[model samples]
Target: MQKGKVLSLEDRIPKIKEHRRRKANRRLIFLLTLFFLLIACVVYIQSPLSQINQIVVYGNDLVTTKDILSVSSLKKGENIWKINKEQAKKNLMAIPEVKKAEVRMEFPNNIVINIKEYSPIAQIVSEKEFLPVLENGTILNKSTLLADAPLLINFKTGTYLEELVAQLKEFPSEILNAVSEIHYDPKETDKYHIYLFMNDGFEISATIPTLAAKMIHYPSIASQLDSKVKGVINLEVGSFFKAYDEEEEKSEGEEER
Candidate 1:
């Protein structure tokens, strides 16, 4: 083998320095990448873009959207991180009309609020004032002949109005639809003497306790009504009908020999 030449210190030193410089450049690049990542994380935590950007509402009719938002502590542009969904829901439920409230958070930027409101079933007339009564027997806001909803007459002596209202609420929707007005006359010994005016101008005599049942069969009874006979359909007793007129009574008396 040929003898190898000895390396000079100058050549060896230059090569070593170049290697060290490359390693240092790599380390600097890594450090800069790590710093930027940390900054990005911090910005994500603090920026509004990461918070709730929208509030959506639903299932409300009478209570306006603005009123609902005003009552709630939640505000648009508020940081979602600070929102207490439970607390907000409780606040919404405190409103009398609100039957239920649901709150949810959507990823990246949204809050949704769902609300359900109570609907009135009938109106109870008291002392010439009409009070809207809900299905649960709860008295709602006072209303004035807004729609043609049927009126519920109160005839029970010493009975609570709320109880009567509850009873009316349980009536089938079909029966309720046919009724236009109800009149209470407690002096009529037969509590069953409650009068009902049909939407079709026919009058019915029924009692409070069995009114709902009779109304269910009213359509069939109404079908049998003679076109010329337009007086009263008395259903106080089971399935019995009577059509009487004062003029007919006078004519019959004259015809008696």
Candidate 2:
């Protein structure tokens, strides 16, 4: 034979049927997927897991959970999926005390909010009340007396106060707690001059600019001193010690005697 005959209809029918079958299979799979997705959507919309039934707050001391909830506007029965975490966090950070806020969704009707509050660095004595100063140089009007926190006297809200807050923020808890008060004792040449009266009866004279760097060694300096003796630890430019004036010392001794 020189050439093959044309294929009959019977042979072509099977190929056509096979192509249609593949198309039908693809359509069926797509329809099945779409149906399942629709069902899933409906179920998720109605399920209790989608609703926020419980709200747990952590790491909040100064900022109350009620305040956080109020700012976030988070309420029970609201859809968990609808809660804007970033927006809630932004609202939380709007409060001066809240440093960091993390909002997370726990499945099965639970929402968790974690808050990190800025610890008060120092307190500015206003009349008899103490205004808490944050690390970011923010002054909070809430009045609370913490014996551990240092009282800042004659320090106005300005660059000096900011520097003092920054310096106090870097100090160790023990070292900071040891300080009882910080008095702004400006000198003729140095307006930033300050004096710190420690709870242990020692005093520190430091300038604003060099306070943090030099004051870091306060603990070390305190350790080397006579615990029973009260004197001034000068950290301005250079570290030195100045005992009280002989006259005042004699007067103090006479009173004690």
Best by lDDT: 2
Please report how far candidate 1 places residue 232 from its true position, in Å: 2.8
Model 1, span 1-257: residue lDDT tens: 99999999987999999999999999999999999999997898789776778899989875789988877788888888889999999999988778899998988778889999877666777777776666566665555553655786663234544545555666777777777887765544764356778786677877667666667788888888875676578777776555558557867999994
Candidate 1 collision pairs: 192-207
105-144: candidate 2 lDDT, tens digit per residue: 8867798999988987888998888888877888888888
The positional error of residue 135 in candidate 1, measured at the CA in angstroms, is: 1.3
lDDT of each: 0.75, 0.87
Candidate 2 lDDT at 74 equals 88
Q: Estimate the overall C-alpha local distance difference test score of candidate 1.
A: 0.75
Q: Each prediction's TM-score against the native?
A: 0.67, 0.79
Off by over 4 Å in 1: 1-41, 126-130, 142-144, 153-160, 188-193, 244-257
Worst 10 residues of 2 by lDDT: 241-250
Q: In TM-score terms, which candidate is top? A: 2
